[model samples]
Target: MTPLGVFFLSIGLAVLLGTARGSMRRLVLGGGLSLGVAFFAFPFSRALGFLSRDALDPTLLALVPVFPWLALVPVLGGLVWLLALRPQWAAWSGILGGGGLALLGLLAQAQPTQLVRLVPLYGLMEGVTAVGVGLGVFLLRPFQRGWWSLVLAVGLGGLAFSWLNTQGHLYLPKMVGYYKLLLPAPPGAEEKLVAEYNASLPEKNAVLKELGQPLLRPIASLRDLEGGLPQEAAEAGYRLLQPSQLQYGALAIFALSGLMLGGGLVLLRRPSLWEMGDPKAALILTGVLSTLLPAFEATEFKLQKLAKGWPFLVQFVDKAWPPNLANPEAGIFPLQSVLSEMLLTVEIALVGTFLAAVCAVPTSFLAARNLTRGSAPMRVVFAIMRAFYNVDRGVDTLILALVFVAAVGLGPFAGVLAMAIHSLADLGKLYSEAIENADRGPIEALEATGAAGVNVLRWAILPQVLPLFVSYTLYRFEINFRVSVVLGLVGAGGIGYFIKGAMDAGHYDQMIIGVIAIVVVVNLIDFASSWLRSRMV
Candidate 1:
């Protein structure tokens, strides 16, 4: 038969066998037969060139001729049949299968390559097969224990592994390079530096040779500046900032402050703080600390360095203050340009929040579990929507702004698009939770009165959730406004753009003005959002 014909025949047989009501012996025999057919059909289709090699791994392709000897299909079918006889075994088998598939995916991600593309398709095929077997067993015998905790543990483990692996491959090397760049040069380094620079470009060296003592002039200039005041101070600062030069008094103070902070974190009686009594929360905290502590140590978080730099920081502040409010070319405590950009930032936030709210309203209803509970298809739709929300929120707003800037060209419009997309995800999640927790009585009552779905949603769900939605939107507006200001650093056109320009040009006076404007605008928005949420609640 053709590959397409074989594919349909295998699926039809499996479905028929799966739906058949029979004794344990009959079901197992039928299931084994179906598995054998599907296994053989897969190889046959691949051999016929109907299934692309790109879509099927070589290992599977090689297994076609040896299908009868493989025995994997019949063995798995037998295991499922045996598990169907015991509820405990069936549930444990499902949990194990799911966890194993997830771990395989994680391992594949850690070593991603062209081959990794095949892993997902292979995993999906195996996962579907396992789930189908589990469901068939479940129909014959149900296992009712809580399996959610097992799933959560597997998921968290996979995520933690992926994060640590990524950090090792990406962040650790970058950090090493950064600190190496900051290292102090040894004495008589000018000759070595000149040699390296000359060696890097032979053409430049040849030109310099023709110019008689070509390298000597540049080397002399470097040597002459080697004993400068700035160099001396930098060398001195580097020495003073070393761990060996850390004062005992500073160490004592740091230890005492840490102790106090740790005590407060443990003893504080607040709703926001994690309860020490909760084992799960404690475990999560421990995991976080375990991951962060090594990173902090690697970065060498030194209190003594801050203390040594205090004098330089003070001198910088002294020079930066006393605003240049007179010069038109550079001066302006609050420049007209800065004020207008701040206003544009606010408008971007407002428009973005409005756009997000409009998009999220309908999407949130589709995502809410309680609303989508009655239908299996709707529940699947809900899962897909929630996954999209997670992906949208997982990406940073600044990164999103950079992407949009590339597509749409740099301006406030790029910032607006970034804010709107990110806020859509955030507000969709918040709105869905609110909708899911809305009073169900009104919905049921409306449905009893023969109200249409739209009418029921309008009369029952919206009234209960609208106030919270409005309040959350205002709160998000405050957040997006701050984000918009930062987005300006990437050419998204806000106060941050001016701030970045000032910093690049060493115009601290202008930069300070822009900073003050942002602070004032953010504070005003915070106050307004707080009052609005309070009144709405």
Candidate 2:
């Protein structure tokens, strides 16, 4: 899209944001951040690369490449600190940093150009030393308690900014492939190639000398070469593996993502320091915008990129339309085959949900923080159970399905086991929360009646959270069915497996039949679940 079109579109987005946020302040903030990134931050940092190639002053230009970290880092630190932190020390930071840079520039100008250029890496050494002092001084957090955290934060923040600077490639997600394409030749390959090329030149050039053709020059560095090599050089193990491609876009990305990470950290910790008394919604939105802008840039998320996928979709539809419900295997009726696979899928979901609910019912009582409050041993159990839930939940159902498929050797049983394990953690966590929120009045009343602990739990707690548990189990059953379809694609045996077989065999017509069966069964299950929930849950 053109710049002017993008500008109008951004305005429309700002207006939409204003409507969503229900305020004018957030609209202005969103617009500023969006427009500023488009016009200022992105363009400015990209232009910084031109400084290395500037012909304005030969001496300054020469020094610029020598100490990239030194020339730009401190000025960037000062500006970020001033904008984000708003500490008492921020103003002095800017002044002292700027003054020091001015002094250094003056010294370099006054000194002999020959001496400055010949000097062995003073800029690099000084920059490294300063960074070291900044990082190391923060380790005494114990000895330096009160106001020292502020000082330590300053030291620690420098490390964060430096990390953000070097890790530019992480934030440039789209350009990673481009960078891999730019990967240079391995060490000493160029030198070896040069050696081989020079050794063969005498014999190769004799023919050229005889024909009065241009004699090939001896290869010194691969930089001197272009596309393709001479016949003799090709015979000698020469490779054009060293890529010379450069992208200046990375300079812009690093600068913006660095500020986003550093500034977000500071603002998250001390929102009062943000501009205009830290309007709560606006501050949160600002942080979100800061995070998402980088992500959008990283992922190459242009609307135009999305448009490129539509042609493939249109072609697939043209091929796949008018569903073919013919027997895939040796089945008498083709439609019954689809129904059979879908019923198998539902069975996997049913078994998974029932097993998970059974395990979760007993486990959740032990995990409830409220029930375990008085006993130290029970509290420990509670912590361990909650931790187990977290760890189990962290492993995705698809990953668990893969593991089970490996163990059980491909069937609906593997899908059932995977869904059960994943569902147990999710249900246990939900059931525990429901138990925690159960009415305390009934438990206290039952305890006062000289009831045993087990009796109190059976009568009082179960009655309160039983409805919620049923509701949660029903919901898990719904999710597990959807998950079972995915499991089939991994050879776990369901309608998804049938669909995958169709797709792999290039039977788009048969695949559409499976897809249609899946959609109809899913809707029927949802309707049944809703009616059951109304009557029972």
Candidate 3:
């Protein structure tokens, strides 16, 4: 076999080995991760190969010799197995798959206009597929209980939400015009905007200029303008009003049934369907919400020029809020300005995570029941730390920043503090878990050797769990990186605030640049964290 083929084989064997041993679970994880890194390293697999190529003739491309599918089948199967087993696999898959498929369809099979028209359909399909597959795996796995359900729920919700955004819809309520409602530019601001528009208006007699005037079309009603939905969503140009009706009806039925199911369960003194570990029921409920919310908030908008042969209803949705197909108007920040904002975001995340990690180790020991020997005083102290963790984790960093901005004011300082507090709580929990899970044999043996509590902990517990703790810290840092950006939206200072500001200013191009930068940074961080964790633990 060729070097690439041999590498792929080794990766597969390693992953299978890791998956087999409970103690060596991380090994399987590391193996899977190595395979991904290797795949990307291949020149043929790089985006440049797929994206830069404009080969129209298969015969000509064949002369260059792309690797046959047989060479990569093991890699493909490995990825598929990972997706079926790993929660995070779905997210990356959706991003790559959805983006690639849409791009391919646009470049090869359909016009830009047609591609836009199909955005919602593709997005829905992707969401459904990811959720179904993930939940199916969850059903097959017994250990995924307790907090695992919450993790799965969040993952699925996030996927569906991401899918919705990909379809050109922000997937928000109709009333939420902009992510945050604008108060008509403070009255005089509207007049100023109007005057500005009029001054820049193309001459009415200019035919080409007249055509461009209607580029964005007007929303026919408040409903039409709801959440910037593309208006031309009539199935293949077939106009259908209340496409959302089916969604609404499903929501209504589910909600009613959920209520009934809950009530019946209560009356009968039994668990509800969701309580019965019914992921399907939970997913149905999730889907119903996904569908119903947009329908109820559908808006009406009027487009002057027909961008595509969209059904009138589809067009209405499109005009209200630009769907994933047609780009949203860039906010104030242009593409050029995105880099600075993203850099700052990454900086804040790294600093904040490091700070949190430093503080968490000590607190975790104090909070661990095992280390505390279940002593009442110690338990009480631990209880207090636990309370702090709960409260810190419960409130999202964004909200904390809102409060912190009022107390400490803006800038990265506020963001850092917010992230630190949240991370402390998170890391504390993880540390405690590590302490709890450590092999008790060595710890007990140390105590039997007449070692003091402090010495036992220092000699036995710390060494065993330090690696796990480090891994968790790195993991949290990666999360904090993303969270800090999100918090920036609320003016906590990061890329998010800039992106949000750009969106408010209707600078679509700038918004796109900011968003693109964020995606790239987050994915990079995720990759790094995965690699680092694999090596450490």
Rank by lDDT, highest first. Answer: 2, 1, 3
The sequence of per-residue lDDT tens digits that candidate 2 reaches over residues 242-269 is 1112122222223233233333333333
- What digit string (tens of lDDT, one per residue) describes model 3 on residues 364-419? 88878786766688888988988888988899888888888889887888898889
1-537 per-residue lDDT for model 1 (tens digits): 322233234334433433442111222222323333323222211111112221221221233232223344335534543542342243333233222322322232232111011111223333333455545454444335436544544454455445434554364443221211112235644444446544555666678798885452334323232222122222332111111122222222122222222222222222122222333332343345345544554687778889999998897677657544447675544477788888998998999999999999999999999989889999999999999999999998999999999999989999999999999999999999999999989999999999999999999999999999999999899889888889999999988898898888877766777888888888898988898888887
TM-score of 1: 0.51
Q: Which regions of candidate 1 fall more than 4 Å away from where they truly are?
A: 1-289, 329-334
Q: Model 3, poorest ten-residue lDDT window?
A: 111-120
The model with the greatest TM-score is 2
Best by lDDT: 2
Q: Between 2 and 3, whose lDDT is larger? A: 2
Candidate 3 stretches with Cα past 4 Å from truth are 1-336
TM-score of each: 0.51, 0.61, 0.43
Candidate 2: Cα lDDT at 258: 29
Residue 266 CA error for candidate 3 (Å)?
A: 30
lDDT of 1 at 303: 88
Alpha carbon deviation, residue 525, candidate 3 (Å): 1.0
Instruction: In candidate 2, list every pair of residues with a backbone clash.
Output: none
